[model samples]
Target: MLYRLDISNILFLDIETVPEKEAFNALSEEKQLLWEQKTKYARKDEFTPAEFYERAGIWAEFGKIVCISVGYLTYTGENRNFRVTTFYGEEDKLLKEFKQLLETHFNQPKHLLCGHNAKEFDFPYIARRMVIHGIQLPYKLDLFGKKPWEIPHLDTMELWKFGDYKHYTSLKLMANVLGIPSPKDDMEGSMVRQVYYEEGDIDRIITYCELDVVTTAQVFLRLRGDALLPHDAIKKV
Candidate 1:
C-alpha cells in the first residue's frame, strides 16, 4: 500500500532560519571570540552556532525571518506544475500570508507535509516562530505526541539516511544517488546562509530555498513511485 499521502495534496515547504538574539550578531570580533569560546556548538574548524550567526545570514536582521517559499506541486495531466506562493518575502507580510495558506489552502490534519530535513529542522523552526507571532500551528505538525510513523512525515533526509548518523548528507548528494536532478548545485547551502548576511539580498536566499525545495519535492516523488520521470530540471536562475 502507498503511504497515506496523495501526490496532489501536499505542500513542499522550506525556511531560511536566522538567530533571534542581537548579541548573536552585533558582537565585535574580539567579543565574538569570547562568545564563541563559551558557545556550545562552535569549534575551531566548524561553523559554531556563534560562527553561524556571525558569518551566516541564518540569523540576519535582528534574527528576523528573511523568506519562506512554499511551492504547490502535484501530478496533473501527466505533468507537474510547481507554484511557489509567497508565504514570506523581503517584508513580514509573507508570514501572515503563509499562515493563511496553511489554514485555508491545506486541509488540516490530512494534507501531508513534505520537506528535506523538515521533520527535524524546517517544521519546528517554522512552527515555533509562528506561535511566537501568535499564529496557530498547522495540524500536520501537531502530531508531536503521536507515534513516529503515525504522523504523515515524508522527510527526504530521513528516508535516505535509513538510520545513519552522519552530520548531513548534502541534498545534492541525495539527489544524485537517488537518480534525481540536483538543481541545488547552483547555490550551495553555505552560500545560502552566507549570501543572506553579506549581501542582504532576500531574493538570492529565496531562490536558494526554492531550489532546495524543488530538489526535495523531486526526491519525494521518486520515493513514492519509481517510474516518476525527472522534470525539466535544467539550470535556471
Candidate 2:
C-alpha cells in the first residue's frame, strides 16, 4: 500500500513539547489542582502530582510545543534528497510559522503527513497547541467533518501494528527492527524538558526533533521496500 503512494507528497515531521511551567510548584494553585485531577487515574498511589509532573508534556493541556521539525523529499533524476527545516523559539511564533508552511506549500488534498505514532500524538498535539495559541488550524490538522478516509495523516507505528490493538511499537524500536539507524543516540524524549528549560538550548532540541523526522522518513522508506537514504542525501535547510 505504501509503495503506491508518491513519496514527495508526504511531509514527515516531529515535535518536542515541555510542561507549560518549569516545575510543578510554578503552576498556579488552580492549575495544580487541575493537573492533579487529570492524572489521578494514571498516577494512582504510586506518585504525587509533583512527582509525576515530568510526564505532563505528553498531555496537551499541561504542555507547550517548543519545536516542530518537518521534512520533504525532492528528486534529481534517479536520486532522492530530503530537506528538513525547523521552527523553534516562542511557541506561538513557531506554531504560526509551521501553519504558514502548510498553507503556502502543502495544502493540496494529495499532500499527506507522516510520522511515527503521529495520528495519536504529534498531529493532535500540534492542533491542540495551535488552538491554545489562538492560531487557526490548518487544513491538514483540522479533521472536524472530514471522514476517516479523508484524513491525510499517516503513522508508522500504526502501520506496523497491522490492526494489532494491544501492541505498541516505539520509533527507536522500529528503527532497530527495520535495520535503520537509531535517532536517540544523543538523548531520549524524557531529557527534552531539562534540555529546553535548564540548559536553554532550543537548538539541541531542534536537532533531536529533526533526527526523529529523518528516522521516521527512513522507516517509511524501508516499509515500502525502498533503499535507505544516504547520509549525503539528507540536507538541513
Candidate 3:
C-alpha cells in the first residue's frame, strides 16, 4: 500500500524547537507559575519546575520553533533526486516562510506531510505555533473538521508501529535497525536547547534538522522496499 503512493506528493520534514527563553528564571512570574501548574502532573513531585524546564521545548506553549527542514523527491529520466530546504531563524519569520512553502507547493489534497512521530508531535506543534503567531493554518495542518482518513499526515514512527501502541521507536533507533545512517552524531534532541541558547549556533541545529529530514525520507523509501538515494543524489537548496 505504501508503494502505491506517489513519492513526489509526500513532503518529508523535521523541526527543531527550544524553550521560549534561555532560562526558566527568565520567564515572568505569572508564566513561571503557569509552567509549574502545567508540569506538576508530569513531574510527579520529583523534579522542580525549573529542573524540568529543559524539556519545555516539547510543549508548544513554552517553546519556539527555530527550524523546519523539508525535503521532497524529484525524478528525472531514470534517476531520483532529493532536495532539502530549511526555514530558520526568528520563530515568526520561520513560521511565515514555512507556511508560504506549504501554501504554495504542497497545498493539493493529495499532498501528504510526512515526518517521524509527526502525528504525536510535529503536526500539532506546528499548528499550535501557527495559531499563537496569528498565522492562518495551511490546508494540510488545519485538521479541525477533517475526518480521520481525510487528514493527509504520514508518521514514519506510526507506520513502523504496525498497531503496537505500547511500543515507541526513536528515529535514530529505527534508522539503525533498518541500516540507515543515524542523524545524531554530534547532538541529540536532548542537547538542542543548550546548543540554541548557550552555543548560539542555529546553523548547527539546522544541519541536524535537515539530516533528520533526509533520514526520514530514506526510511520511508526503505519501508517501500526501494533503494536509498545515493549521497550524490541529495541536493540542498
Q: Candidate 2: TM-score?
A: 0.98
- Give the range where candidate 3 is weakest over 10 consecutive residues by summed lDDT: 181-190
* TM-score, cand. 1: 0.75
lDDT by residue (tens digit), candidate 1, 49-127:
5545554334232345667767666555766666664445533466667767777878655677788878777776666
Select the stronger candidate by lDDT from 1 and 2: 2
- What's the CA RMSD for each of the models? 4.5, 1.0, 1.0
- Of 1 and 2, the candidate ahead on TM-score is 2
Candidate 1, which segments miss by more than 4 Å at Cα?
A: 1-4, 20-38, 44-52, 55-63, 90-92, 144-150, 163-168, 227-237
**Which clashing pairs does model 3 show?**
none
The global Cα lDDT (0 to 1) of model 3 is 0.93
lDDT of 2 at 61: 100
Off by over 4 Å in 3: none
Query: Residues 131-166, candidate 3, lDDT per residue (tens digit)?
Result: 999999998999989999999999999999999998
Tell me the whole-model lDDT of each prediction, alpha carbons only. 0.64, 0.94, 0.93
Q: Candidate 2: where is the Cα deviation over 4 Å?
A: none
lDDT of residue 234 for candidate 1: 22
